[model samples]
Target: MPKRSNYWLGAGLVFGAAFGFALKGIFIKSAYEYGIDTISLLSLRFLFSVPFYIFILSRKRIQEESHPQVPTITWLKLFAVGFVGYYVSAYFNLLGLNYITASLERILLFVYPTFVLILRAILLKKRITHLQWLALGITYLGIVLAFLKNFDAHQQKNIGLGAFWVILSGFTYAFYLISSDGLIAKLGTTRFTSWVIISALFPTLIHCYIENRLDIFNFPIPVYIISMSMAVFSTVLPTFMLSEGIKHVGSGNASIIASIGPIFTIFLATAFLGENIWLEQIIGTVFVLIGVFLISWKGKK
Candidate 1:
């Protein structure tokens, strides 16, 4: 594909991934109404999702006609991603969701773009473009402006702790975005996504076993349905799209593009969770769109 086409395709993929992931908060909140805990919900998500990845992995392996040898170091890197991206970040986000509204949870998590920019600069010595900086400034200005009134209006009692957890979730996930970019480029997004998620599955299962939360089947039927929905729409699909997104746009640009996620989450939260949307938020959404467009259109990937 042409470079311009690649960039637009990647942006669309990231946008799709963001919307899918935005629904995850709604699904989790819905499942929580049935009294499902974080670990159990996570376990069920992986259990339901991993089969799809395993099937993909096996099919890819067969098509290749032989196992390609991966270095021990590469395996180690995938494991690290599994640990931080899947286990710690996911757990923290879900923990925060328990205390905060789904809208707030997504808003807090959107801060990952800042972390992504910082990590790229510090770790990869990647140059931050003028457009990216401008976009970042406008994007966050909108976030603060939109949420300035939100904090006062927010009714969650443990907002501080919840915000802290969600911020940590953003931080860890930013690291994953930075660190996994090369892996995605080298391994191909489909294969890399499958392996990384499979790596994630082990630690998740171990945690479930340790906590005696392995019995995911005991959940109410509605919970099971929601978990399956999240696994397909949120987990499996978005995971690959995000990987492919980074491959084309780079982690920094992809992060900027992903700011749309909170917008999607907020709307979904309003529709499903009855969260209120203020006029300021609508204005902020316009600002965010402007910022995202600056990065997306002003460059050719």
Candidate 2:
């Protein structure tokens, strides 16, 4: 009974995380309306988020001080994972969002689980289960249908380019999760997350510096409010919740719960951003959700 209760609690947490993450597109779009550029906005997000990470990291360091020393190599691995996973992947995703609808961007980003599956098969020499192949087929077909609609509904060249960047974001994120699996298992979710975020924050600052366009004082107040909300609600809150959810419900079930994110994003986009939803998007989202369900569901068996 306690385990069952925990499972429900974890599911709730995961759903909350998904909902929070789904709000990111809406927030970014709102920020853009204030004439805030991507780099500055991204910088603001990390700036607010970094203090939380520092607190988390400090607590973790104190806790682990009594334990056997961590190897230098481990820190290097964490740094590498942070760079490619959060910094690079997020930058590309933000770039894609500049050209694509929030709904489309969320849908594309949600396909990372599928990428993780495929990459594992190819790189790890894992056997491709029959059900997985079916999931892959469904997911790809859905993506194709959605892409066709996007191409038809918007600027063709921009849609095509945006889709490419979003897809690359998904790929990089998948690779990050797959590669960092062992580290996550060893370091505990919150601790590992703290280190990764801390590592990623530095690079983000460096990139923002290189862009050299962030006149931080001159931006309107709404941008600051929205960016801070983004840092707390979308970035820090969801990340820790998802990590805790994985601890209770396990990653597979957590992922299945998170599959709702794209749908939630579509609704938010329509209501807030006034983006239209068409039949193709509905059908594509359904297919993608089912595909993700199949993959995550089968992993438990």
TM-score of each: 0.84, 0.94
What are the clash counts of all predictions, listed in order?
0, 0
lDDT of 1 by residue, 1-301 (tens): 4399999999999999999999999999999999988899998998999999999988888899667688899989988997899888999999898988888777667767667776877887978888789888887787666666667886677877887898899999989877887887778778887887788888888898888748777878999999999999999999888878878878667767777887888889999999778888777766766765665555445
Which 10-residue span in candidate 2 carries the lowest summed lDDT? Answer: 148-157
- Please list the residue runs of candidate 2 whose C-alpha ends up more than 4 Å from where it truly belongs after superposition: 61-67, 155-157
Question: Which regions of candidate 1 deviate over 4 angstroms?
Answer: 1-15, 125-136, 241-259, 285-301
Winning model by TM-score: 2
Judged by lDDT against the true structure, how good is candidate 1? Answer: 0.83
C-alpha positional error of residue 204 in candidate 2 after TM-score superposition, expressed in Å: 1.2
RMSD values, in order shown: 3.4, 1.8
lDDT of 2 by residue, 1-301 (tens): 2399899999999999999999998999889889887778878888899899889878777977476567888889999999989898988888888888899899888889888888988998988899899998998888887777776775434787888888999999998988798888777778788888778888888887788745665799999999999999999999999988888888777888899999999999999999888899889989988888898888777
